[model samples]
Target: MSTSTIFHRVAFIIGGGSNVGMHVAQKLKTEGYRVAFGSRNPDIATLEQKELFPVSVDASNPESIKSAFDLVRTNLGEPSIVVHNVGIHFQPPVRNDPFSVSSDTFAKSCNIQLALFVAVQETLASFRSDKSTTPKVFIGTGNGLPFLKNMPPFFLALASQKATMYTMMDYASRAYAPEGFRFHYATLVGPDGGLPNLDPSAEVGFYNSGPAHAKAFWNLISADVAKSWDYRFTYAGEPLMT
Candidate 1:
């Protein structure tokens, strides 16, 4: 695969119906990529008007994800870029009590990691089969929870799952680097280089800006392959190896 070859610029974004996912999709569409937004319930009318494709997907279900990928391939060609933006987080029933978390809740939260693994496998298979020179990139959206030593007790399940997800993606980045594929776990932080406020309605700072994340993702995709294997990056697109 060489850069000179012509191929469709297709992107598949999991959990792309709202928030950061929609922002990334819009950015890619503006960059001339055919974008597919995948969620449990897709807003087809809005997506069609934006010239974006919509596919129904349940991130916790591997079969649903596989079907979504198939639909993208059939509608927009093999996606050279795949973004996994789905995650699970919930406050414990008994705040500040880690043990108050139920087994079923923890199991359900961890299942997103399994979904990410399946998405990665599907992306790699698609990349291996495509001969285009476009960058083959898979990005997993993350946050600062994984790095905190004293994580909030209510966030125990989320912290554990994110740490595991980070490890899995880091391994994938190294394992597939020889083949020119890029795997990145983007950790979004506040503008002042601190943890972002997790409240959806919080207007803490610029780090919460969807466009900023979109730009960071675009930068990662446009980076030189030689410098793109760092496995993790900050919201500013700076590599974070440690």
Candidate 2:
């Protein structure tokens, strides 16, 4: 990005330490937008010379989240974009039946997702100025009700919470669209074993077909974005795009 384009707009990315969040940050930065990455691990925060700020934030704690936003506002100006992507998936080692699931595990997952939506709204309300500069929120998916098929009904607490947050997000978008806040969600059908513009041949255990699937999924979603429809849960274990 040229010096003239640097800091033209700003974005706040939650869970921006690794993977998709990091890729999002790189994309935004390449486009000349200032970015701030929020995470519990400050040490691993993605770095930029001046346009990126690494903030220590526990997404599950409201106060910590609030403080992180305050720091971002004080340090990076108003961020127009917010991407929320924080979650966990545990196997049998963590699960002990629906009744036996520890409150901490359940609440942590639920609260983090909920807190992200709340934090974004609060941050937008607090940081936005009268002069608009392209505001958008792109949340990572995997919480839709359709993704819960064949699973125990009780296992849906996290999904339920995510659905509620997205519902709230929809309302916020409609209510605040005049103010320039746009909301979007991206759902992943499976893991991203390799990244775009990388050497897949050197990637160990990488599915030879994974990159094709990723590109296809992105293309399908981009087409969805063009048509301006709310992409919802899957049908029969297939993504809505499929």
Candidate 3:
């Protein structure tokens, strides 16, 4: 399916309250997509937007995710593009001690991984039902943790979850490629392959901003079919075929 034909199609974004999610949603809206923002507490401004639909969703709950997709389908038709931008990141109380992290916190990370699995299943079902020739794209956001060999001890849980997510996306991309479904896992990192810097004063070259992420996502979605099968890539759309 060509980008021109899918301009007016529907796009559903999970975790749309995040900075990167909001930028991607705006990009899709500007490109003529009927955008649906799924978050636990959507911003009032987003809910008021004309072509943007804000649906409440809990990223850790499978039922909540399904319900949110249902609402999107009811209001904006089936989503041809689905983005799983939900993630959990926090430091252990003892900073460098991975064992200091509570079991509940680790469980929360597991729940998020399960949620992504559910979201991917929901997207696949939606695409199978829709008869339109529009692109069936699913983008999963990640960081450098999954690919790192010496990850920080305090980020153990997050690293584990990200590794699982990367594996899942890899499988999905290969399994669904023949069906015309594109599954991409985008790693948002610096040009030198460093993690994102949240500090506003950080050097521009060392940080990957929300707008950069948005642009990378758009590039993935608009990529030609021959290039679409490349699942893992950097925030700048550079392929990491490994």
Candidate 4:
């Protein structure tokens, strides 16, 4: 260990302008981690940090992600954590036409929600390079609509992509855990089954407060050992997976 080396734990939050993303960033800062969040839109990405960094990154584009990580490495050192919070949605059709998957919807979901290929490539490059410490990676997600029964057609298209994402995340967590990396896929269930199969009447759910979700996520990231918190769903700080 050279005294010249500076170790500042950094966490980058993608889509960090969202309600959930903002809270997550705030929480990470409180936990003493340098944070950066990327947004596609400049308007919402306006949030700046005196000590932290923010950049423009299109989740779909590997070049954009690579560029952002490059800057992070230069400015903040290799990121010890990466949280993918980007999301995409399509409005449900009116009470008439059946739900149809549009090419636009499919592509946008791949770009935003799944964040396709670039996301994983950059994560391994940045986090896996330094094996002396454990690197944490978490993807914020919602309950898979496709796997659930009795869902409305309005969600058909979105469900297809999200379900695929869930499965892929599962595989990633399993494959990477064998190494010294911590990979997590936390699916949130909000009020009124907001994202998936949830009872509208259930109180004390994940939506109880935005900070609660952030706290739970932080707990997973800061855990002493990587538990099965990855590949799990949580509601109000409770892990749904045993």
What Cα-based lDDT does every candidate model obtain?
Answer: 0.78, 0.55, 0.78, 0.64
Write model 1 residue lDDT over 99-121, tens digit each, in one string: 78888888777777777778988
TM-score of each: 0.88, 0.68, 0.88, 0.79
lDDT of 2 by residue, 38-74 (tens): 8888654237553467888887777787787777667
Ordered from best to worst TM-score, the candidate numbers read 1, 3, 4, 2
Supply candidate 2's per-residue lDDT for 213: 28
Encode model 4's per-residue lDDT on 23-99: one tens digit a residue. 88788888887777777764432465344467678876667878888867776667778877654556544532335
Per-residue lDDT value at 85 in model 1: 84
Whole-model alpha-carbon lDDT for candidate 3: 0.78
> Model 3: per-residue lDDT, tens digit, 1-54?
233343348999999755678888989888878898888988758466555777
The residue pairs that clash in candidate 1, if any, are none
Worst 10 residues of 3 by lDDT: 226-235
Which 10-residue window of candidate 1 scores lowest in summed lDDT?
Answer: 225-234
Cα TM-score of candidate 3: 0.88
Clashing pairs for model 3 are none
How good is model 1 by TM-score?
A: 0.88
